[model samples]
Each structure stands twice: as C-alpha cells, then as structure tokens.
Target chain A: MTSRRQLLKSAVLGGGAGVVAATALGSLGPEAAFGAAAPDVEPGAPDPDFAEGRIRSIKDNTLLVLGSNMVFHNIRVVDGTSLWKLGPTTFDQAKPGDGLYARGVRMPDGVLAAESVWLNIVNIKGHVSNITSEKIHLDHKGQEVLCHRVAGKSIAVYSDAPPSADLSLLRVGQHVQILGAWRPDTNEVDIATVFSPH
Target chain B: MARSQPTDPPIDLQAAVRGEVSWFCCGTAWGPCSSTGKGACGTCNSGNLQHAWPNTSDACWAITRPDSCGFALSRRTCGFQHRITALCSGTSVVTSIADCGPQTDLFCGERSCCGATCATDRIIDLTPAAYSRIASLSTGLRPCEISTP
Candidate 1:
C-alpha cells in the first residue's frame, strides 16, 4: 500500500499543477470534474453530515462514537470510504478509544455514511523546549507534548519558504506549530509538518 | 435577522470578542485527515493561513450549534477573514474561514488559562500555518480575541 508520507509529498509537490489543470478544464465545460460539490445543509444550522469523537465500538462496518461533548454518533464506512491513521489505512485498523473526525452524508436514519475518516489527528501550537534525535519536546501552554519525527513523512516549512523534508533547520526555544497524527490516548504525536519562523 | 454579505465592510478588529482558540490539521498529511482535502471551502490548506469558525453557514451552525452552549454566533461563510490575537503573547494573525468546528457545546464553559489570562468557551479553530504564526503548536488551546481584519 502507498504510505501517507508519499501521498503528502505528491499532494504538496504535484497536486497544485493538477488542480490548476482541472480548474482550467472545468471552465470550458460544465461537466468537467471540479471535485465534490458543496453540501446543501441550511444556512445557520449545525451540520448533520460531519462528526468528531472517540470510537465507542465497531460493529460490522459501522462505528459507534461518543463525541467530546457527550453526544453519540453512528458512522458507517463503505468500500468508498477513505480511512487514515498514521498513514493511509483501513477500517480494520480502527479500534475503540480512537479519536476521529469524519465527513460524509448523514443518512435519513441519522447514521453518517462517512466519505472520509481521520484517526487521532491533532494540530497544536507550542514552544520548542528541546529537540533530540528521536523526538521534539514542546511546551504547549504549560502542557508537555512529545512529538515524534517520522522519516520521509515529517516535513518542515520555515517562514515563507517552501516545504522541505529536512528538520535540521529547527531549533530550541522557537515557537512552532505542528500538524500530526496523535497517538491514541497519549501526550505524543507523530509529526507530519512543522511550521516555524526562519 | 438577515446574514451579512460577504462583501460587507470589514468589522473593526478592536471591537472583536474573546474566546478560546485551538488548531487542527487538514490537507496533505498522513492518515484519514489527508482525505479531508481542502475543507468545506475547497480552499483550506494546512500550509495556508486559515481558520474554522463555529458558524460559517447555516449547515455549519447546525453542526457546531454554539447556541446550544448559550453562545450565539454570526453566519460567516467561507473566505470571510477574521483577525485573531493571542492574549498571552499579544501576537496576532489574520486567517480566512476554511471550515466549521470546535463543537463549542461539547466543552461549554471550558476554559484555558495562562498566566493571568483565561478564556472560556471554544470559539475558533485555526490551521497550522495560521496558528503557528501567533502561537506555539504544543499549546493545545489559547485565549484569543476575534475581530474582522
């Protein structure tokens, strides 16, 4: 299977040109592919189509989730549904206690037919307290976070510079933001991208 | 009440309100979040300066429903720019609305405190590019002020 790190490189390096080409073709014909259409939900109401929470159980191809706010969600995953964990993964990789964010069409029965599901994803801002060969220690508003670096997957973008797969430019005491996959039930995360000032 | 037009004049940044802000990842990454691709506006990127408001459209409001937590929010659609200032560091950044989130009701009255400042209620979520500009990524949430840029 193609790993998510490879996907990230392709999307960042190649997706831009592809998107531009698709947009050009879309302008020439109404039927040209332009990606998914916007949802038709009401103007000021909560979206019934998206759900985020922790997995309570997995039954058949469905996930019973408990939201961070105490709400319950029933999410269905079909063959077309895309699942992501540390990388592009499958539903079988999911387990109870996994935090998730899913987008799909909410069925009339109140179940969400998920089109995409991301597990343990987290984006946070923090101060780089220390950096070692294996991990970067961060102070996030007084909370400690350990960010593990994934080779070929973790990238860094400094200031307005383009993204590079190099982490050598990072330093201690700098404030940075990280986008990564959170380890289930931990204060640690697998780094995907790190944004920092030059 | 009728919603404000996208082309309406920019709201004053100084008069903006206070809330707790957090960050989230989307677009071109490992795992399931990679499929999120561009967010609801088809324009959101983890590399771009963008944000998700509780109420971007009626559909988004239906999901976030800040009102359920006793916080009423305006219907600001995608591409609407809001300038957010980090209260602790006095740092600020301007980000456009890219998605809907923070499920304010889930953490109703939830607060994040730093030093002498504390912010209650989850109000806004930002992209990595935007949040890192004004704060550190290790900090899960920070107190912030929101206003139109």
Candidate 2:
C-alpha cells in the first residue's frame, strides 16, 4: 500500500492529477479543478462548494477554517491541490490567520475536498501613483499600497490583449487592477497579474 | 423565504458612466466584513443582485464624491436599476441599488483599462452575487461601464 506521504510526493513530482486519479481519489479534471469557475447560483447566495475565510488551524492535511458566515469548515488538502500564495507554492506555506478562498467538492461529511487554494490573494483596483524600478505605488481608496514586482513572474494584460511579461506600458496615473498575493500584517502585495484596460 | 421586489422609480436615460468596480459583503457578517452591517437600505445581502451607489444621499455623497475624480454622478435612490458591464469580459449584469458606497473621492483619478476601453474612478460597489456574475470573487475588483437598464 502506498503511504499518504508517498502519494503526495508522487502527486507533486508527477505534476498533479494522474496519480490522484489512479489512487481512486476523485479526478481533478481540467474543467473542474483548473477553471476556477464558481457554481451557478443566485448572485448573492453563498456558494456551497466554495469557502472563504481565515485559517484557524492546520492538522496534517486538514485545515480548520472560520468562514465569513461564522461557519466552521474542514478543508482536506491533497497532492492535487494547487496551492498559490504570492505565486504557485506548496501547502506548507499556509499558516494561521492566512486568508483564503478554496474551491472543491464537498464530501458527505461536509468536508471540502479542495482542488485549488489561493492564499492571501487580493485584487486591487487603483491608479499608479508612482513607479520605481522595483515597485509600483498604488493609490487605493486614499491609502498607499506598495506593490512589489516579482522578476520573471509578474505579468500584465493590456485591454483585450493576451497576458505578457512586459511592464513598460504601465504609465503613472493609469488606473489598473492588480491580482496579487497580500503580504499579511502589512500593506504590501506582490503582483501576479496586472490588468490595464487602456 | 419569499421576498417582494421593490418597484423601480422612473429612470432618466443617460450616457454610460465609466469607472472601476469593486465588491463588498453585506447582510450576514463574515470575517473582516462583519462591520459592514446590513447596508444603508437595510435589505442588502451578499447573495442578491444589488449594488451601492456613491450618491445615494447627502451623507453618502459627503463620503464618496465621484466629482473628486472629475466625474459627475447623478443621485438615485435605492432599488433603481443600473446595467453594469465588465470591461475585461464584456459581461453584463443588471443590479439594483441596495446601499451607498465605494467612496469614490478616496481614490480620485484612479483608472482601469481593458483595451481601447478604459474607465476611471470608483463609481459603484456590487454585492457578491452581482459581481461574481461578471467577475470572480477572489479578484475583488474590475474595470466597468455603468448605464441605466
């Protein structure tokens, strides 16, 4: 019998899905696991298959979370789980008080069998207040948010164009929306994708 | 529980307004959103196709002056409908005003773009249900164009 540790190692090494399927854990198919699509429900209704909250504790592979609705949730993380912090990362990087949005299947016992977890991810709509070689200053709701650029990792999408790595088009005072990893306990974020409509 | 929809007041046809759009949770409390309360309308919910307009009231206008961003916004009461389109996806969702929000003046002159189409300032705040219909919840913000339905 393959141990859970071995299964995790294989899953991480083998690149995410085939091993989980072969091991009889549900298939994390392309459409379901990677699309990051939310369930079809009324606009303001809480999604049954989604959970958003802060991590209260971590026991082995299960995460104890206190949701925005004051509900308790147990999220079971596995090898197939795509954990993202500032960028693509591993599960061990998740810690207490880290905010998250998890999408997955809910088991019979109400445990969410997570497929993807985005940790401390925040999308900010702001104007470029200033720019330095290493960081972009964003004026968000009168607050200054220092956004750092990750070399070779940060990307941009300019008005209907495909995402590219060129950051030169970003002009000071341009309104931009940034998808980034929030540096907890601080006002900093590492840019992952920056979208400029113009 | 069954709920009655409020009758909408007559809308004055106007040109589409452009700006940044964001989401805020109301109704049932959750995490850092607990302080948001049930919104100014008292009927706000995260799961409804509702939104917050900066010009809902004089008090609200004091807090969210869109003019500070060089945009003039007309005042509309709760339950008035506005058709909002996401610049990124061109996805549209018609939502009614449920509360006052988005503090436009705070981030005056902010802009967002999708291509040749770009929007400036913070003009509206949508409920999770309304926003998620056009953009993902995790994204928190999007560039948008708003108009009367």
Candidate 3:
C-alpha cells in the first residue's frame, strides 16, 4: 500500500510549478482560514514542530543541526520539501554552517520530516542611514547592518503597493523593514524585499 | 486590571498610534533564543500574550527615547492592555505590557505601510506568543497600529 508520505512525494515531484507555487507562496497562509489545525505548543516556548539553528553536517538527505539552545536535531528532507535560501531553491544549495528554520512533522524517532526550510533568512527593522549605488546601510537596534542589493533579485514594496524592481523611492533616514538572507557570521545581508512607507 | 497611579498622566488621543512592530523571546527555552529570563518587568513569558512598550519607565524612556524620532509616546506601565494591529496581515491582538525595548532612537525615522495605512518608528515589541497571533514568526518585523482598549 502506498503511504501518505510517498503519495505526497510523487504529487510534489510530478506537479511541478503549480505545486511549487502553492507551497512557496501559501506556506504561511492563515491556517484558520483553511480550517487547518496547528500543532499545539505551550505559550511563549519554542515550537516543537519548528527548528531554528545552524546546519552542522549534511549527510545525503539528512541535516544535523545545532540549535540555538545548544541542543542537536536531525532534519530529513524529502522531495516534497520546499527549500528556500535567498529564494525558491533546490536542496543542493544548502551548505554547512548556514542558519535555517525548518517546519515539519516530528517523527517518532525524533527526526523532523521537513516540509519547508528557510536558510540564512533575517527579517529586520531599521533606518536607512545611507545608500550608495549598490549598498544600503541600516541602523538596526544600534547596530550597523550592511545590505547589498542583488540586481534582479531585489524588489521593493512602497505604501502597500505592488512590488517593483525600482528602489529609487528609498531615502536616507526612512524607517524600513528588510526581508533578506544573512551572510552568516557577518553583519551583512543580501536584500530580498524592502518594505517602506512613502 | 492595572489602574493608573496618582502620578500617571492621562492619554487623551482618539486616533490609533501607528508604528513598527517586532517580536522577542522570553521565558523558558527555545531555538536560538535559549532564554531571555523574565524581562524588565520580571513577568514576561513567551507563551503569554504580553508586549513591551518604549515609554514604560524613566530608565526605559531613556533607552527607547521615542521622542528622539519626533514621536511623543505615553508612559504606560506593565499590565496595561493595548490593542495592536499588524498592517501586513490585517490581524489584531490584545496584549499587556510585559517589558521595555526596541530602542526607537536607534532607527528613528523608519516608516512602513500597507495600502493607505502606514506607521513610523518602533513603538512596540510583543512576546513570541502574542506576535504569532497576528503575523508569522518568520516575519520578524511589520508595520502596525496601536490603541488603548
């Protein structure tokens, strides 16, 4: 008999872009709206179904993670998993020492069967202290964060408008929220999306 | 209920105050957070619907200093309830003051918007439990509007 996991794997692999779109964009869609139930977790504590840490080792399809609490975790990636680094990506792009957040079901053996993985992602609020031709400097919680613009990959959302490739509206001293991929071990990040109010 | 003290000033505004919203971990242990202890008020928990206000106390005011960014914020102590709405997700949560933080002065003139609704600066920080009620935990920051309930 075909198991649920095997069925999902086949569907995800064969479905291509349509499946990828739903998994990528609707990954965080409101669970309540769909009547989907969330795994119960204690208030204020780290969620058991989610793991946040740096990858220590990658052995084939499994990732050994060293969590922020100094605990260790094993994350298993299947074909159905949606892997996102700077953007929608494949499993091969994953590397050692990269920070990540994995959401999935915890198997009885304690291995996490990851459904989604976001690597080196950092969401930050800051003021644009300065802007050059390619870099935007931000002051985040008194710390200076260097943000590099990836030409084709970078986009901006102004005043709740649709995203555009144009970043000309950004000005010095305007408060903004940046969704970007961290450079790992550095204060720099690669800008993905910049949200600003005009 | 947290009653205003004799020395506490009245907040007389009718419009909702808008600003940037973020989340922090507190109490117990979790992922990269480890433990934030009990926070400034000594009562914060990650699982509770609590938040941090910039102008909680004189020392907190000195650190956050919303005024440095041209915004005047009222001093609300711990346990005071405030309704926070996340502009990005169009969700709202009622949480009480649990600590002090997000140093508004650091990113003084930051602005964010969703459609015609917009907000400026960092004014509130909610616990993991409270923040997740409105926006995804992966989305670390959002534009929001705050009001006294």
Model 3 misplaced stretches (Cα beyond 4 Å): A1-35, B1-20, B23-51, B62-99, B103-123, B126-149
- Could you give candidate 2's per-residue lDDT for residues A53-81 as a string of tens digits? 77999999889988766788898787667
Deviation in Å, model 3, residue B116 alpha carbon: 8.6
Candidate 1 fraction of reference contacts recovered: 0.04
Worst 10 residues of 2 chain A by lDDT: A28-37
True C-alpha contacts between chains kept, each model in order: 0.04, 0.12, 0.08
Superior by TM-score: candidate 2 or candidate 3: 3
Q: Model 3, range A1-198, lDDT digits (tens) per residue?
A: 533333334434445553454354344333221122335444333456567678999998889988765779998776557677768788899999888777665666788766667788766667899999899999876778899999898888774467799998899998877777888777888988887755
Candidate 1 lDDT tens digits, B1-149:
43332333323332687888888766554333433566778776664677888877767777676776556667778878788888877767777888887667655665655566776777899875566445544444678888876
Whole-model lDDT, model 2: 0.70
DockQ of each: 0.06, 0.14, 0.18
DockQ, computed on Cα atoms, for candidate 1: 0.06
User: TM-score for all predictions?
Assistant: 0.52, 0.59, 0.65
Candidate 2: list runs displaced more than 4 Å: A1-43, A68-70, B1-149
Best-performing candidate as measured by TM-score: 3
